[model samples]
Target: MRNAVLLPNGFVLTTDNSAGIGEKEADLVHVSDEVVAYFATRVALMEQWAAGAHPISIVLHNFSGNKNWDKYVEGIKKLFGEIAQPCPEITGSTESNMETLQSAIAVTLIGKQKTDSAEKYTWYVYGKPCVGQEVMTESDKIADLKKIWESIKSGLVESVWPVGSTGIAEECKRLGLRCELQGWDIVKSAGPATTVLLGIAKNRIEEAKLHFGKYFEEIN
Candidate 1:
């Protein structure tokens, strides 16, 4: 299912990342607080935009102390800039009372959907599945958020599902697809949604293939 809650007014998309992946003393990955927040926010933003929702606000949950607050906000803004969209209003809290060893953060995006009508489309995968340290080292294989956003706006893509830790096969199952995705490690975790599942309009299949080039692969 989509990682969003449908409210009477709009959808609330939320995602979080934690563990020893930050710059904290206990973090095993040794990445900056900003990088950690960026990928975490990327998951939520992709979920919001994939559902054709316009983001209105953002809520951040910071557990890496007060000093990292501004860095987290900067990361959120950077993601929005990549999509050429203005950063939405952001408000959240930081865990200042206690010193946490690992870096942890969560992001919530409030967005409004533009249409209610549903359309049938073909499914495709964009980018390779990468998790953990691969997220940083094999970053080039990750899907381009900017390109995906533009394709959706241009009517080339009808819907999108960012593959998470559940992997590609499970996500397809969640979508109710019966076919197997050949030539891919369908069970590998796509940490922070390094890969994206695109629902393309039948007529725009070729166009999307051309637009995404080698990153696009048909799900058979």
Candidate 2:
């Protein structure tokens, strides 16, 4: 499915990736392991949470190596660790027989939502994103993501559509929505998907503000 598959038990299933577009050269010598895991895993989990799913497990596809595995896991843990929740079971493999020139990882989340109100939804872009360098340098990034998750849990956010290397402009086109995004660069890469599109309702805007705080942005 292009989107999450709605299951009969009120759950949803989805997957996402955080590949370096095959640009990383020589054993990922230049890329940061922690940054890769953080963005990649967060992207997958966010997609699940967007569908109102409570992530139960994560299956990681690690192409880095044994030496980098701990760092990757550490990054993933940091993502879930923000909410003070135990991370879901994680199991994955590292390439030992061969060496990849670049870093790549695919994160799959298995989750279930207890209930979905099935309300009519409105779309908006969320996050303060920029291209390049700061993907790792930013300190407040994870806390900001936590705020978005908190808003989702607060019933203010119905779902989220992650904006990957494709940037906001392409995602808006894909969703058949006009890119009314203001005060931002909509076509730049949100490296490691530092941003996402939120699905919400008009009535819950206030609640979103209360929970998301500085992380919330509107693009309709």
List the candidate 2 regions with Cα displacement exceeding 4 Å. Answer: 1-13, 19-31, 138-143
TM-score of 1: 0.94
Per-model tally of clashing residue pairs: 0, 1
Q: After superposition, how far is residue 40 of candidate 1 from its true place, in Å?
A: 0.5
What is candidate 2's local distance difference test score? 0.71
Worst 10 residues of 2 by lDDT: 21-30
lDDT score, candidate 2, position 91 = 88
Q: Candidate 1, residues 135-211: lDDT per residue as tens digits?
A: 88998999998899899888888888899999989888888886466678989999998999988999888889899
Per-residue alpha-carbon lDDT of model 2 for 125-211, expressed as tens digits?
A: 767565455664664542367766777767677767777777888888888888876677888877655778887877987676666
Score each candidate by Cα lDDT: 0.84, 0.71
User: Under the 3 Å rule for N, CA and C atoms, how many clashes does model 1 have?
Assistant: 0
Best-fitting candidate, scored by TM-score: 1
